[model samples]
Target: MHYDGVDYDAGMVIGAELKNGKVSTQIGFSVQTFIVYNPANGKMELMFIIKNGQVFLRTIFIDKGTIEELLIGSVIQSKNYQAGNTGFKIDGETGIAEFNRLVINKDFKIIGDASKIVLDNTGLAVYSTSGGVIKLSRRP
Candidate 1:
């Protein structure tokens, strides 16, 4: 799969699982973190995984020095699924942390949804939503 314009080589197949009568494949890899600018949420550093042709957002981190203080220590997880022909959705949440003195608590809720996915065989996946368009292109 592609992320931040880079196409990573397929790592070792970890395993597979049956879901809804279809086997989903899993692969694993490691790389330095990267950032994605979301029109709805600004910039976030993220790590992702792909299974069953679907992309899963595994982690989100904001450095302590970032300007967005409200998002400090925030974490996000999401999964992308095919909606229909040329369409898709990303359903997930961001765990928001509330700090009071020495106490901290996290609250998370469903957060993102992207529709109208246009896939380009030439190595591009375009996601269009009300906020704006996010184009993910593969590396050569």
Candidate 2:
């Protein structure tokens, strides 16, 4: 992963596969964090997580996602800040991306698999046989 900002630029790539004979399968993925901007406590200005320049894991905080706690990131990104609502409770800690929309299973591994599943990039809902729809934000 690599990052470039006003202060500095950095990136790294570790090419190695996870190996284990103890378990039949293992789960793995690459994680990267950027200091591009700051959100409030329990939040951070989300840059995005993209794989292969197609999908975009968004970082925008919904207004209803906790107005007070979200305003900080908004301000950092030159958005309006409603400082009066500072009493609003924060939802969770920083570095926590909303993965609730992702779908994974024994057969459909999110990482370390070569299977080609339907990935909807047009912000349209794509449903699996089990009827769970994946609705991701459009590419940035």
* Winner by TM-score: 1
lDDT of 2 by residue, 1-140 (tens): 23464444344554545556443444444434322434766676665555554445455555655344433442131133222211112223342222222335778555422122232334444345455555766777
Residue 42 of model 2 has an lDDT of: 64
> Once model 1 is optimally superposed onto the true structure by TM-score, how far is the C-alpha of residue 68 displaced, in angstroms?
50
- Assess every candidate by TM-score: 0.17, 0.15
TM-score (C-alpha) between model 1 and the true structure:
0.17
For lDDT, the strongest prediction is 1
Give candidate 1 misplaced runs (Cα > 4 Å): 1-114
Q: Kindly report which residue stretches of model 2 are placed more than 4 angstroms away from their true locations once superposed.
A: 1-103, 106-116, 120-126
Q: In model 2, what is the error at residue 83, expressed in angstroms? A: 50
How far off is residue 123 in model 2, in Å? 4.3
